[model samples]
Target: MSDTSGSQTNITDGQQVQLLERVSVAVVTTLPCCVFLFINVTMLFTLRSKPVFCETSRYVLLYNLLFADTVQMALGHLLYLFAACRLFLTYPVCGLLILLACFTTTIAPLTLLVMSLERYVAVCYPLRHTTIITIRNTGVAIVVIWAFSSLNILTRVLLLLEFPFKDLESLQMKEFCSGVYVLLGPRSKDYDRAFICVLFVSAGVAISFSYFGVIIAARSASTDKASARKALNTLLLHLVQLCLILSSTMFDPLFMALSGILTRIVFVRLYRVLYIFISLFPRCLCSLIYGIRDQTIRPVLMQHLCCGFLKPAVSNSK
Candidate 1:
């Protein structure tokens, strides 16, 4: 009797520990997510609040990129919360959420590619930058990016249709909803891997070309030394951001690989760490990089972020 009682106590203690861990993980992730979401939302508002932001081509691209990242971050967090809470969604429902997340995920790198090229044009062809990087052209690029991403989503939907959904006892998922779990077959996985590889590789090449093109242009005596230097710095930042985004994509596979080796407790701890840094942090980088670094954006973004507190100070100074 004593032994049985002790075993029950042990099991109860273990369950309590797990509950504590889950709550801690949720708090840690949720707090940062809420903070970043606020900043991104503020930055988005700041972008649209001013005529300069709306009229400029790069700002238009930044708006589109930030919009995509904001959506991706929100959806990603929602999905993470659902999984943490052990909320099992229907296949159709889960697929929709994952597809939306995936859709936005593709936009970041592609927009970065365009942004890099825009910088390249600004440096290499200063005379024609206005002609080449017009607001109309920027809008068309945004449209093309969305259309390309939609086509990818459409292909995934078709692949999902091939799944034997009717054979299942119900539409309700048997496990936590994730991109890997939602993939109904090997073919889906293969196509996904292939698509991601192609997309990132192509974007990387284009961005790298732009980076080098800027470097070569910087060497020319004709180029504005200050402008070329700034573009080079921006290109370098873009490269780092791209690498971070690429690392975030590896989280799923990394977790899957580590799961088989690590005990559940260890795996859970590792997962929280990886998800925080790898998945969540990258989504917030755009706001941090652009909001703080850009001279034009910094003051306005700070004003919005501080809820107009800075406005009085600026007026007083002026």
Candidate 2:
């Protein structure tokens, strides 16, 4: 009887492990990779097909934002897929992935900041907006944003390198991926938290102010109520996008803190599920929002989807 019970227990444990692996691979790896790839490629095609759409300053900025999001998905979530599949990555390769992820993640919020400011100028100072938010200036702003974000992440990467990787080989052998599990000293951890908090707060404040300015301008422009209402709706959409992007970043430290306190298997599983949803869902949401919400892109997207899917059937019938 004792031997039978022990065997049953072992079988149960094995089944549970297999189930967890399957779930993780599906949610974290396969679904996100396919969704991100499809959305980003579709967005690029839609945007690039029209020269006039690409020439507009607002769409140009949005194109850059989409580009940044695509890079972020590639560097961050795509690597999560590799990790989910239990692929082995070298220390240098892992570090480089981390650096690229950090760089792209940082660029996203800053690009949104630029977008908000562009909207602010367009709504508040319409007469000067053409001069202020021209394609050349927008291009310069993108360059500056990228340069700043890259430098910030480069510093963090350097700081990260100082941590000992003595057990990295053993860890990789066991887990088959690094999984962003670098151990930082207390001071280093504190600095990281501080940096993240500051960045979040600063960007959040700037976005808020830009939206507020747009609102004020809208209210004052009594002659152009229709345009004001449209601008307001667009700003609201942007706010939703902002929240989704922030959801990916803001929840991580909190989850890390919870993991330290609640060290249960269930808690770990819940965290994995939540992380997969929060991180990957936003990329899909952002792409969908842009494709559906943008006047210039929406028709183009519909046309492409219709032709891509229906043309094959029509051809076969002929």
Candidate 3:
């Protein structure tokens, strides 16, 4: 009787392990990549169909945000997939991925900050907005943002290359390349943490001020209630999107901290699931916030999709 009970317990454990493995793969790798591809493709098609959308500063910023999100999702998820498969990655390839990831990571929040400022100007200084946030100016802002992000990422990469790996086997390039591992010593880790915190805090403060200024301006505009309402709703959407993106950034460090407490196998599986969720969830929110929720783009997207479906049906009848 005891032997039979032990056998049943072993079978249950095996089934649970299999279940976790399947879940990890699906959540960490397959779902995020597929969803990001679909949404980004849809966004590209929508923009292509209506080229005028790119002319507006708001749309241009939003489109760039989408592009950044797509790139980040692609790189992060590909790395996760490789890690899951236990595949080896060359240093150059891994460094490139890390560089791109850092670039996108820096871009996302900065773009959100830009968007917030754009809305603030449009609402708070309606008369000056046209002069301030023109196509040329927006393009310049984007270029500056990219340059700033690249500089920061480049500095980090250079610093990472300088870190001594003599004492730490796990910090070796090959091991660090497999996952989102950084081989920073205590001092380096503190610096990295400070840099990230400062960056996020500054952006957060700017975003908060922008939104608050918009609210005050909107409230004072008693002549155009409809426009005020629309502006408020749009600002609300931006706030939600900012929160989602910020939350996604916390997952990696959070998982690393939690791993020390959890069993190894359990930590690995949970980290996989959480990592993909972190990468993909904000992207889905971005699609809804910028694409589907927008007054201009949503109609074009829906029309394109409908036309695509009806084309096959009409051809079949012919």
- Highest TM-score, which number? 1
Q: Considering lDDT, which of the candidate structures 1 and 3 is the better prediction for this target?
A: 1
Q: What is the Cα-based TM-score of model 3?
A: 0.81
lDDT per residue for candidate 1 within 191-252, as digits (tens), equals 99999999888888988999899999989999999898989888888888788888877877
Which ranges in model 1 have alpha carbons more than 4 Å from their true place?
Answer: 1-20, 312-318
Q: After best superposition, candidate 2 residue 165: deviation in angstroms?
A: 4.9
| Candidate 2 Cα outliers beyond 4 Å, as residue runs | 1-24, 27-29, 82-90, 164-180, 221-223, 258-265, 307-318
RMSD to true structure for each model, in Å: 2.8, 5.7, 6.2
Which RMSD does model 1 reach against the true structure?
2.8
Q: Model 2, residue 136: displacement in angstroms?
A: 0.5
Alpha carbon lDDT of residue 83, candidate 2?
Answer: 50
lDDT of 3 by residue, 63-119 (tens): 888888888777777776676655666655776787788788888778888888887
Model 3 residue 17 lDDT score = 88
Q: What TM-score goes with each of the models?
A: 0.92, 0.80, 0.81
TM-score of predicted structure 2 = 0.80
Tell me, by lDDT, which candidate is best.
1
Across 85-172, the per-residue lDDT of candidate 2 in tens digits comes to: 5577665667677667767777877887888778777777778888988889989998998998888776776777676778454534
